[model samples]
Target: MSSHHLVAVDWGTSSLRGALLDADGRVREEQSHPRGILSVKPGGFTEVFETLFGDWMRPLGTRCLISGMAGSKQGWVEAPYCPCPAGLSEVRAKVLEIEPGRISIVPGLNDSHDGVPDVMRGEEVQIFGAMALTGLRDGLFVLPGTHNKWARVKNGMVTGFRTFMTGELYSLLSQHSILARTLDTSAPLDEAAFLQGVTQSDNGQGLLHNAFGARTLALFDRMPTRELASYLSGILIGEELRTQSVHAAVDVVLIGSPALTQRYQLALQAAGTQARTLGAEATWAGLHAIHSTSHRKT
Candidate 1:
């Protein structure tokens, strides 16, 4: 009936992570599984949840908050998205309760641009968590993943945002495209090649033309086969950056795994924009913040 302890879950499309937090919001234990929403059979979410995290929920007053695609139509429970210009209050108000006072799903955020709609599920929690951890009420936040998100926050509300298939494109190009033949996709990042791609993206020759250069560059011995993947990555991420009107004066925050965020940091810095990085902790803090607020309301 009370929320003296918390279990925060970020269950995405391909993977899920859970954190057990004490009353102080510090993580006490953590678990991860590859059983994302897609892996769960229809009507089997409860079983999956109980299988993975039921032990943590046995204590009295332990509440659980699930975020990400777990709230989508295909998820355990469909938690409708809260329209943009949303903050903790707006999102908290719309959370879908699957098990009253014990388990809930945090609603995602949606925004439209020129009649084109863009949506995100779990990234919103990371944004709020970043805000709570950093004490920043306003800034530009980017969550880099398979589909990267660029969100604008004003006075603690996400006013608008955009999504780019940067990572997905990189995957396709590096693994399935013609360029894949010459690319050692498993090679570690080559900063020089990556920055080169970033610089090339700014030459005003659009992505289609520049992306082809990856193949030509390797074909002509201009770039090594091992470095082609990084070069290609730079091009895609750079292309994603081309559309943003990033101001040098504004603060930029990057949230994701260290490896991914480092790539974005390099690309952003190449364009003269500096960014701060946050990791998985943001997700836990965000869910904890929402849980605390909801507990207060009760």
Candidate 2:
């Protein structure tokens, strides 16, 4: 590892991940904390962050680059989303200010048309990293998360994208809604039930209409709660797959955790859209890409 050091963070609503990388961009050390945005409360980020990084700071003199919800309206500070076709400099200039450290915040991107708005945060870094790796000028990139995003890359820029709250809605209904009463969170992913829901979801059955099937199926005792939960999972994912305009002619890369990528790959396979796992080292990949550009420019 190079002697010089920098930090990269992917902070979300529920958890925060940070990496200490060498000047050459290899991760030397990393840490995570429960001081996610939700847990930090309003204006408590400095204290919470200090608790997480106080020890590491003794090593000293490391600059930081952050992505994800950390730049959102509710995060530590609003770094503001840059419009599409933005460059590395435009993103870098929006970095939020912090004391006692050199920290840069990567901004989100937004596009609106026909009274509908599509937005993204952490995925932009992955997209930039993917372009650097693949040398692809245009393709489809999918980032699966609480708010799954499907993006269209054109001429090495994010020309357009859409967000589907598939994971978030699943969590909401599964935990807080009546569906929770009828669904089992600890249940395994039932391939059979998953396939059934995937198939049904494709047959012109609208998502809202199909959502009722979960409870209805349970009401008649035709589906077990575990199976129902699995089916619901398949339903939302499948519906998103069916409706989205994925550019399959160019390569489609999926960036996310292994299980999420696998589940999406299975669903895309069922929908006849091919996508490959792009690895789960998003923060590292993003950090390396940013640091490389930072070096080139300097």
- lDDT to native, each model: 0.93, 0.78
Instruction: Please give, for residues 155-260, the per-residue lDDT of candidate 2 as tens digits.
Output: 7778878888999999998889878888997888888888788788887969888878889999999998779888998888889888876645667888888878
Summing lDDT over every window of 10 consecutive residues in candidate 2, give the lowest-scoring window.
Answer: 92-101
Residue 82 Cα positional deviation in candidate 2, in Å, after optimal superposition: 0.7
Quickly count the clashes in candidate 1. 0
Model 2: runs farther than 4 Å from truth? Answer: 1-3, 58-61, 87-89, 97-101, 133-135
Off by over 4 Å in 1: 1-3
Error of 2 at 100 (Å): 8.8
Compose the digit string of candidate 1's lDDT tens values, residues 88-191. Answer: 99999999999997899999999998998899999999999999998888899999999999999999999989999989888888889898889897899999
Which residue pairs clash within candidate 1? none
